[model samples]
Target: MKKTLIAYFTRTGITKKLAENTAKQTGADLFAIEPVKEYSSSYLICVGQAKLENLQNARPAMKAKPQNLQDYDTIVVMFPIWWFTCPNIILT
Candidate 1:
């Protein structure tokens, strides 16, 4: 059987919940894509930061990446939409 991985990035925990539930139902390994520098908890500040990053086409540093990522035959990425797309941190 092919191994499956569920990788996700979440700001408000909503995407995390969905990722966890999906992983549970699909029997997939879960990986959280975290940034090296955490974003502000303030929604407005975070949105502003996201907007700036998007405008600059920035790729923020990540805390870690899944080990043996190539071993998984299927990888599902989950994240909340930021400026009409995935967050910049996910690009790291």
Candidate 2:
């Protein structure tokens, strides 16, 4: 099996659990994609923030990144659906 990395972003822990299961099944390293400035924990506030960020085309800074991306032959990216697309941190 090729070396694999499972990177994921989670707002409500849903994606996080899925990523963990995938990582375990595939024997891949796990990496959490976090924002430098975390969004609100409240669902309503988070939704509002996402909308504003989307309108502005904002790419929030990521708190962590893979140190040796070249070492992994396969990379799996996972995230929650936000505004019918991905959150801006994944684009960064």
Candidate 3:
């Protein structure tokens, strides 16, 4: 049989919930993209890093990008508008 996978990265969990529901509905395999350096739960850190005037907004690094990208024909990307753009890591 053909295969389908739901691949996503969610920091605040809103997209995670949506991915779960979509996977259940479609009977697709689910994959969560997580950074090696997880962010702190404190809202202050989020706002601080997301600061528009500060260059710190773009310096945070992800441990690695998901491998096996060629395995899936379809991929779902989720973002939360970090600096009016998708998370910097997604571009990697």
lDDT, candidate 3, 4-89, per-residue tens: 77767778899899989998997877877676666557778866655632454354455655567677777776656666777654
Count of clashing residue pairs in every prediction: 0, 0, 0
lDDT of 2: 0.90
Whole-model Cα lDDT per candidate?
0.91, 0.90, 0.68
TM-score of each: 0.94, 0.94, 0.69
| Residue-wise C-alpha lDDT for candidate 1, range 1-92, written one tens digit per residue | 89999999998899999999999999999999999888889999998888898889889998887999889999999999886778898887
Error of 3 at 20 (Å): 0.5
Off by over 4 Å in 1: none
Error of 1 at 70 (Å): 1.5
Candidate 3, which segments miss by more than 4 Å at Cα?
A: 52-67
Candidate 2 displacement at residue 16 in angstroms: 0.7
Tens-digit lDDT string for candidate 2 (1-92): 57999999998899999999998887999999999999899999998888888889899988877899989899989998786889988888
For lDDT, the strongest prediction is: 1
Pairs that clash in candidate 3: none
